[model samples]
Structure formats: structure tokens, C-alpha cells
Target: MKRKGLRHILLPLLTAVMMLVVSACGSSSNAGTNGATGSGSGTEAASGASQEPASQTASGGTGNGEPVKVVWWHSMGGELGKVAAQLVQDFNASQSEIQVEEVYQGSYDESLNKMKASMDSKSGPSLIQVYEIGSRYMIDSGAITPVQQFIDAEGYDVSSLEPNIAGYYTFDGKQYSMPFNTSNPILYYNKTLFKEAGLDPENPPKTFQEIKDAALAINKTGKTGASFAIYGWFMEQFFANQGKDYVNNGNGRSGLATESMLNSEAGVKTLTWWKDLVDSKAAINLGRKTDDTKKAFLAGQIGMTLDSTASLRGIVDGAGTNFEVGTAFLPKADAADKGGVIIGGASLWILNNKPEEEQKAAWEFIKFLAKPETQAYWHINTGYFPITTKAYEDQRVIDNMAKYPQFKTAVDQLHATELTTATQGAVMGVFPEARQLAETAIEEAFGGKDPKAALDTAAQAITDKIATYNKTVNP
Candidate 1:
């Protein structure tokens, strides 16, 4: 695909975030409590007990033999869940050979855990959405048929897939999974607060120093200054923007990552900068939870923050018409740095044990979800950057961009990022645990510990964790 426009940059950043989530498993057998609830308003129940079960597909269509029912387990809920349901409805209505039943499997971790249990019992869904961090473990588990296998066997035209986004999932010329919901981090600021503080509302901070300057001004107005969740994903972004790797072996793109490099000079510099910001009262210690910091932003308690682009809709709805919200590229550590941000969000994988017909039916549904029209609909409804290169040209997407100019800023920033290994993201087997350690290290730094000491402790801990994980998977 020809790379053009701000939309082009999303693929690389998207790949990075997907490469950071780790694997999950559960012992639960009950689907209802395993985070399987119905989509949105009608079926928000915990067990995800659907009104339309597999029987509907068996009885609904003709001439295509019995319509095959393909179960899709996903982690989306709330507003995003509504959009997912609509996509399934449209796909089901557009054809008769397949019927997709989307089961809400809680958060990414919860869904993967249930999926692992289901696989062990040989009753897993036809397709499962796994976060990027779990990619290494997923490949090691030998549970799913690589989407690349299907693509190659069917001679599928995957040219429509965004390269940087697709690149993250690709290893040894094989795309392991299909890119689905994708996003990047951005700096969100309250324009009204900026103006109140006599800072230029139009010019948001472009670097950490500028953020500190803006935060100091905003704090003088008696409002909380900038704040962010102590998230490993954002820290990964900070590292990527500095052209630094999160883990060894080409950020785990080239080979198995056995250790973390987050305690190096780059890591110390980034963490120390964050620590100084906190010490000067220019940034808030919003703790480790992302939701807490998001609330702080939406409640107008804080003037600026760094968060995923996915939060755009919620911030819009929560802040209402009383104040204007603005978004910019996540402020760089250095203004002249060539590094770019990484993308966050998950992707879809097809399971291996399903019957041939069932597998094909699942692929059909997956391909349908990748269409430009479908991507545009999803993008407009959920704030996730569309995965298809052409989706941006769709009228709906164009209209939405015009309506919310802040959304366009994300596209521009994404296009500005150059693709590189660091920006491609890290793929560690114990990435989830590693991320927690990173977050904990940041929290320690925020609490006034020496940044290098805190990071060194976390780095050493991850190295030990990786060694143990490698034994189990590689043993």
C-alpha cells in the first residue's frame, strides 16, 4: 500500500503496543463468569448469555448448506461493544454461509485466560482476539493456525492491510494474526484551562520541557497540571521515541528476548525527567491505574495528560460542550529526536482445532471485518484509527475528521513517525509482567527513589522472570 497522509504513521506505532501484552490463562469452565457477556444494552449480563444462540445460524439460511456458526471471543465492551455487535450483525446479514457469535470475554487478560481454558477443553471459539504482548506465547502454545498459513494457502490479497500495522505481527515473513482495533498515545489538553493560564491553547507542548513549562503555568491557575497513568505502554512509547529498545534481540523482533534494557542510560534519563516533573508539582502521581488518570482528565481536575487515542470519545462526551479538548503528538523527550510513538490495542487470531469449514467461515468473517467500509464504521464509532489504508478516504471518516479536528492531529502524528525496530515495539513472552514491573519502577521514582536505582531493580526482576518463562516455553 502506498504510504501517504497522517494515517500512514499509525501502522508502526500500532505494531509496538500490540507487541507488549502477555499471555493469560484461566481455570474457569463457566463461560458466563469467564467474562462472557452480551454486547451493550440488551445483553450486558456477566455470563454473556446471548438471546440468539448457535441454533439461529443452523436454522436461518439455505442453499449454502447449513450456515456454519463461528464463535468470536473478544475483549471489547460498553460503547465499543455496541460497534462490534453492529459489525457482526452487518456481516451476518451480508452473507448466508456463516454466522458470527461475538462473545465478550472481559478485558484482554480475562478474554485470553478464558480462551486458554477453552482450548485445553477443546471447546475454544473459532477465532480469538489476543493482545500483541501474547504473540510470542501464542506462537509457542501451538494452539492456533497462523493467519499467514491461511493467507498463503488461499492466495489472499492482503495488500489492503496497513504495512506498519501488519509489520508488527509479521515474523520471518509470516503474519501471525490480523490487525484489528489499533491506536496510539497522544497528549490531551483542556484548551479552556490552557487559555485561563495564559498559555497558547493552539500550541500544545512538543517536548517534555515544554510540558513542564505549560504545567507550571496551568498549576499557577490553581488547576492540577499535567498527569498520566503510570502505564508501561506509555513508558514504552517514551523509549521508542528515543530510538531505544524495551527488550533485547531487536525488541524481540529478531529472536527471543532474554532481558530488559529499560535500566540503561535512556531509561534513567526518561524516568528521571518524569520524577523531576512530579517533584516540581508540574505532574500528578495518578497512581498505576489508567482509569483513575482518565477520570482526572475528564473531571476537569487536570489540565493536560498523555493517554491512548481510544479515550477521545469518552473525553469528548464527559467534558461536554463546556470546554474544548485538544490532542497533540505525545510530547517528545527531546524536540529534535527522530523517534516515534508505539501503537496500543489488540488483534484477532484464528484457532487451530476447529473443523475446516468452520475455519474457512471464520476467515470469511475476519476478512469482512477488514473491509474499508467496516473499518470506517468502526473508526467513526470508536476512535480507534482504522486499519485499512483506504478507510481514511471513506466519506464517513472524512466527515468525522472534519467534525472533530483533534482526531486529525492523531493521524498527522502517526504519519510523522518513521518505522524502525524500536518503534515496531517489543515482543516478550512475559511482557505483561514486565510492563507491571516497569510501572512499579516508575511509581517508585515518583515516590522519590533514584530513577536509575528503581529502573535497575525492575530491569533485573524482568530478566529473572524472562529466564523462568523461557524455561517453561523453550524447555
Candidate 2:
């Protein structure tokens, strides 16, 4: 080579470097630009050890390179959690281009807290499953990207997704997260209890008064009447069924927090009904402390309940053969019923701090999950209603519903629902905290304070919280 190049290769000198490099070219470590590391992951190598291969990316619908690895955080506890874990494995096995890892934290709030901890350290999973109410925290924290943009860039067909499914994720007409595991509250009446109470086994309470009367009638049979848990969700659904919105800005789908409107007519009416039940000793106020009431229902100690469709699997599993768990649509408070209940399940959100290539890979897993067949599989395995129209029409969903008809109860409510702002959902800041406040408000109302006054106080507290959170979130 050049004399100057040779001068730099001299041993322990600049001239010696050329000779060393030339001789070492034949060595295995010199095969790649950075030592051609064998792509080992999960542990960093010793100092000067070559880095592994670059992270993979999804090729969208094209059957190109290896599937990307996407980490997911979920809280689909109990049997469904196992099913979701298996679904991830199945998807990873189904495609060579994408691998999904599902991690289960405990309950909904626990999962959110975990994600928040991740945010605090500037490290978080690529995908997070957040309930509808977590929108303010996720969006304001700037942790999640607007998923519709990712779908558009990747050319994934989103037209198949129902607008109603996407409706809850919209903020000022922009969609942040797509749909997953959406559900509405429904009445789970005990057939044997109903029969013993002289009520028709095939029929259930058609209105709030009817439920109260059923509770009173069933109470005579020595069974505690209706056993409602998750008082907030049940009450929210109860309000929606009566055609009243809970949160403002059209339940936060329109824009930032608007007004706390839960103290209105529908709200008071629903709480009044609950109060009446408590006063007449027709029902018991069960908080979120434990599933004691759930155990009571399964053990035939309680007659009816209002819980999520997500509970369907757990309730069935827990019931064993104690008594048949019969499902029905929620009752209306008004004489003229509006429609079905609002959506209440978690949706998967993509983190924005990821590298561009890794982001696309995560998007691949999301698109795979949105497929009709995949959605149907998820819905059948977990009692969540499929968020897509095609999923509802899928043959697998059809067959599964026949076997477990209760799976279709929430789906059926969708059809019966009237188009109203109430059914969309709520978005009060610190809504989780607000849920506790509402519970306390319910307790106060049950203690004989006018239902309207109790809700008004609760709404004022919620409004004050909204102001406080807005400052913390925006400042």
C-alpha cells in the first residue's frame, strides 16, 4: 500500500495499526461493521463487546422481514388474563414478522400506576392497556401517540373498525387509541331467585322500579336483594340508560374537560332509586373493597347485580353449579327508555418515546389485533364484545355466542341503545379519585340526604378536582 499508510501500521505506533487491521480482517469479530455481534438480547455484553443486531420492524401486510417484538402491558385478570397471554403467543406464532409479549399487572388502577411509574423514569412498555377513563392522564402526560396516524402511515385498513368503537378515543375529532375489550354494564339476575320470588324466570326487571320491586320481592325469600358492585360504573350506566350525560364536552370525546354534569336530572333520579333501595332494605350498598357481594351472588345469598361483561367469565367460573347466572339489559329510570349502556373496557395505546422502526413494529401487532377474526377470537375467549362489525358477524363469534348466549347480551344492548351523549362515557379529571367521591356521595344519599343534594355536592367536588388537575396536567 502507500508508504504513509504503512508508516501508520508500525507496532505500538500509527504505522503498525494498518498491519494489525489487515491481519485481523480474517478474524470472526471483524465480519461486521461493529464486530458483527450474534444478536443476543436481554443482557448487555462486557465492555467493548459488540452490540447485537438492530431491533426488527414489522412489514405491515407485506410478508417481509422478521416480525417486530412488541411488549404489551395488560390487566385482564383471572382466566381471561391467561387467554390474553395465549392470544399474544398465538399471534407471535401466526406471523414470522411480529412477536408480542403480554404482561399482566393486577387490576385496572394497578396497571395505570405501573405505567405511570414507567413514565416517571422515562422508560415504559411499547404498548399499554388503559381504560377509557385514563385518557386525560395518558394524553396530558404525552406518553401515547395518536394511533390513527400510525394506522394511516402503515396503510392498515381502519374502515372496518366501527366508528362507535373509535368514538371513545376521539379528542377534538382526533383518535388517540383504537378500540379493545369494550363493554357496558348489565343486570345479572338470579333465575332461581326470581322463580322463588314468584317473578317469571325468563323475564327480568325492565326499569329501575322493576328492579327495586324485584329486590323487595326477592328480599321476602330471605335473600338480600340486588348486590351491585362498582357503584360508579353501575350508576354511570344507569344514568346513560336514562339519557343524561355525565361529563362535559360531550363526555370528553369532544375536547378537554368541560363540565361535571352528573348532578342533573338523570343523575338524581338514578341515585334516588338507589337511595330508595337502601331505605326499603331492598338492596345492599357494596363498595369496591372486595368481591364479597359477588361471592354472595354465586352462593345464592344475593339475588341480582350490575357488573361488567368482563365479569361474565369470572362470575361463571365462580358460580360453578350453585345457581345459573342469567344476564339481561340494564333497566331504565324513565318511562320512555333510551337504549343501551356506555363503553367501559380498556384499550391498547402505543408509547411515543420508541424509535421509529420499533414504533412501526408495535403498529404491526396492533393491526394484527384489529383483524375481525382475531377480534372474534379475543371476544369469544374473553367476554368483551368485539369492537368491529365484522367481528360480530364472524363465524367463530356466531358459533361461540350460541354456546354462551350471555356473551351476546352486551352486544345486543348496543342495538337497543338510543344515540345520546350519556352513553359515550365520562372524563372527569382524577376520575378514579372521583369514582371514590361518587361512592361516598352514594353512601351519603343512602344515609337519607336527598339524592339530588348528594350528587350536586359530589359534582361540585368533581368540578373542583377538574380545575386542580387541569393546572397540574397543563402547567
Which structure among the candidates has the greatest TM-score? Answer: 1
Candidate 1 clash figure, as a count? 10
**Residue-by-residue lDDT tens digits, candidate 1, 45-82:** 11211122111122223346778889999877765677
> What TM-score would every model get versus the actual structure?
0.86, 0.81
**Candidate 1 — which residues are off by over 4 angstroms?**
1-64
Q: Worst ten-residue run, lDDT, model 1? A: 37-46
Alpha-carbon error at 450 in model 1, in Å? 0.6
Q: RMSD, model 2, all Cα superposed?
A: 16.3
